[model samples]
Every structure is written in C-alpha cells, then in structure tokens.
Target: MSLNGPRGSAWAMTERTARDVDRAKHHFSVGPSAMRWDGETLVIDIAEVSSPLPYKVRGTIRVRPEMIGSTAFSLDPEGRHRWHPVAPRAHVEVSMTDPGLRWSGAGYFDSNFGDEALEDGFNDWHWSRAHLRNDVAVLYEGKRRDGTPFDLALRLDRMGNWHDIEQPAPVRLPRSAWMIERLTRADRGFIPRVAKTWVDAPFYARSKLSTRLFGENVEAVHESLSLNRFRSTIVQGMLPFRMPRAIWR
Candidate 1:
C-alpha cells in the first residue's frame, strides 16, 4: 500500500507467504489489509506500518465505478501479458485515520497479468490516462526485449463502449529527478508538460501531465516503468529498505 499526498507519504509492502494470504470470489486479504467488493463498490481496508519509518498507515478507500469495462488487451505477441481496465471511470473516496485526512475525486482501476517477469518481455513502457468531455483516453506504448515496439490508443465512453483511435504524436517530457526518461502523447504541435510528480524512483515514475489529446485539453495521469533499471543489482539490493518482509502469522 502507498499514500502520497501533501499531509505526508507512506509506503508499505510487507512480504507475506501463501499461508498468510486468503482470497474468495470478491474478497482478498494479505497480512493485516484486505479488499472486498460489495456489489456496487470496492472497499479497501489498509493497516500497515511504513517501511524505514514505522509510521502507522490505517485507512479506508472506496471506489465506485461509473462504468465497468469488460475487455482485456494483450501486451505481447505471444499473449504472455495482458492489461485490463476494470473500472475505466470511477469516483474514489479516501479516509485516513492515521493522518486524519479525507478527500474524494476521480479515480481509475486496472489489472495486469503475465506469464513471465516483466523484464523478460519488455525494456520500458509509458502509459497515460485522461478524462475527456464525455470519454476517457488511455495511451500505452513500450519497447519489447527483442527490439520490437507496440502502442495502443483507446477511448472509452460513459456507457462502457471502447473505441480505438489514432495515436497522437509522441511528446517528450523532462526527465525525472532520478534521471528516468519520461514520455507521453499529445495532439500535433502541442507539448505535454509535467504538472506534478507523485512517485519518482530509480525504476519507475508517476506524474501528472497537462496536454491536449484528441482535440481536448486535459490533465492526465502518467507513468513510466523501466524494467531494465529494476533488474539492476543495485536496485535489487535496495528493495528491502522500501519493502520489508514480515514473519508469517
């Protein structure tokens, strides 16, 4: 679990064995935290201690989907990886007891699954999602390990209809604080600017971009992931500090 905000930021990824995990049709639990779907909404209960700081991070997040998506797209030619936009549009409410904060806003939910490690299939990837006047736009592109490239431009309407649109021209953004490359897509002649950076790490970066997409101006949530960086020995050695392992209960 991770929370990045003005009040403070907390990240906790406790490694738990299979014995400490439980799951059902609509509920899943690992260690002290759990997520459950209650017919209309998805509720997440988080109870964790931040790594390297030991700060309490207890909160409840509710995600109410405005429209549910039903299609999953393949990310690789061999069908080894897939991406699904479960909730293309949603309303999210955040209530944190540890920090005594509450807020609500537009949100999105998605899932990704693969048969092999991400590094074995890709070099890096850039993705962004934005809300248009009556639809949502998602852009995805990446370079494969074998030097192949793939891209997808999709738009979803309020009624959960999906449409494939022409991909806009690529726009380069400033590198992250860690020197990670950042990129996005925008209409011709328009440049995309980084409005805010939420998570900036050696292997990944998440930020907000102000750009024009498909004739609409929007503030999009953007992310870049470098599998090569994540596979480095230095980053692997530093993972324990950010993601501590917990003893089996």
Candidate 2:
C-alpha cells in the first residue's frame, strides 16, 4: 500500500506465507492485513508494518469500477507467467483513523502470479498506470530470461471496453537516487519526469511521475523492478530489514 500527496509519500509492503493467507471471493486476509468487499466498497485493513511507521494503518478505500475490461496476459508461451488488472479505473476514498490520514482519489489494482519464480522468467520489467478522463491506460514492457522482449498497451473505458493503443516511444527518466535506471513509455512529444521517489532500493523502485499520455497531462504511479538484481545474494540479504517475518508455534 502507498500514501502519496503534497506533504510526502510513504509505502508499506508485507510478504506472507500461504499458511497465513485466507482467501475467498472478494475477501482476502493475511495476518493483520485484510481486504474485504462491502457491496460497492472495498475495505483495506493494514496492520502489518516494518519500520518508521509509528501507528498501525487501517483504512477503507472505496473501489468503484468505471470499466470492467480485464484479461490475464500470459508472459510465457507455456502460460507459466501471467498478469491481470482486475480494476483499471477505480474511484478510491481512503480514510485512516490512526495518525489521521484521509484522501480521495483515483486508484488502480492488479495481480501478477506465476508458477515459476520471477527471476526464472523475467530479467526486468517497467510498469506504469495513467488515469485518463473516463478511462485508464496501463503500459507494460519487459525482457524475458531468454532475452526476448514483451510490450503491451491497454486502455479501458467507462463502457467496459478495452483498446490496444499504439505503443508509445520509450522515454528514459533520470536515474533514482539509488542509481537505478528508470524508463517509461510516453508520446513522442512528451517527456516523463519523476516527481517523487517513494522507495528506492537496490533492485526495486517506485515513484510518481507527471507525464503526458493520450493527449492529457497525468500523474502516474510508476515502478521499475529488476529480477536479476533481486536474485543477487546481496539484495536477498537486505530483504529482512524491509520485510520482517515472524515465526509462530
């Protein structure tokens, strides 16, 4: 989960085992983090935290789908790797009691799952989502472990229709403070600039950018991930500090 605004930006992530996961239709709870569907509202309760956050975070973020288009994109011909964006344009209203955080804005949700590990199938990937008027556009580009490249551009409309737009030209943004390269696709006339860096790690980076897409200036949530670096022993050694798991009897 992430909180981004004028003041600052903060992000939290947790990794849990299958044993801790409770799953059902429109209902998911893993340890202290849970999300449930209440009619048209999606409630998220996040208590699992690692460092710097003084209080546990719990919030009800309403998700109203403006577009219903969705598909599971197979990253590998063997169907071992796939991605799905269930909600492309979701109207989100966020409210947190502790520490008093409240905001209402647009949001996006997607799921990526695969039988094989990420490094086993991907070298790296760059993903970004831009909210357009009455629609949402998502761009995905990456290279497979075999050095083959993949790209997709999808736009979902309020009428539940999907359009495959022409892939925009690639634009290289400035490197992160952590020295990781960042790139995103945009119109040839537009330049994407990272406005804020929420998390800049050895192998992963998440940032917010202001870019022009589909003829509109939009603020987008962008992420760059390097599975090759993540597989390194040095990066693996740093995981525990950000995502601390506990043992239970």
lDDT of each: 0.91, 0.80
> Candidate 2 — worst ten consecutive residues by lDDT sum?
48-57
lDDT per residue as tens, model 2, 104-212: 7777777899999999999999999998887888999989999999888988887657788998889998987767778898888788888888878898899999998
List of clashing residue pairs for candidate 2: none
Report residue 66 deviation for candidate 1 (angstroms).
0.3
TM-score of each: 0.96, 0.89
RMSD of each: 1.4, 2.2
Q: lDDT tens string, model 1, 1-249?
A: 767889877788888888879999999999899999999999999998877788888999999999888899999999998999999899999999986788999999999998998999999999999989898999999999989998989999998778999999988899999999998999999988898999999999999899999899899999999999999999988888888865522
Which stretches of model 1 miss by more than 4 angstroms?
246-249
For candidate 1, what is the TM-score?
A: 0.96
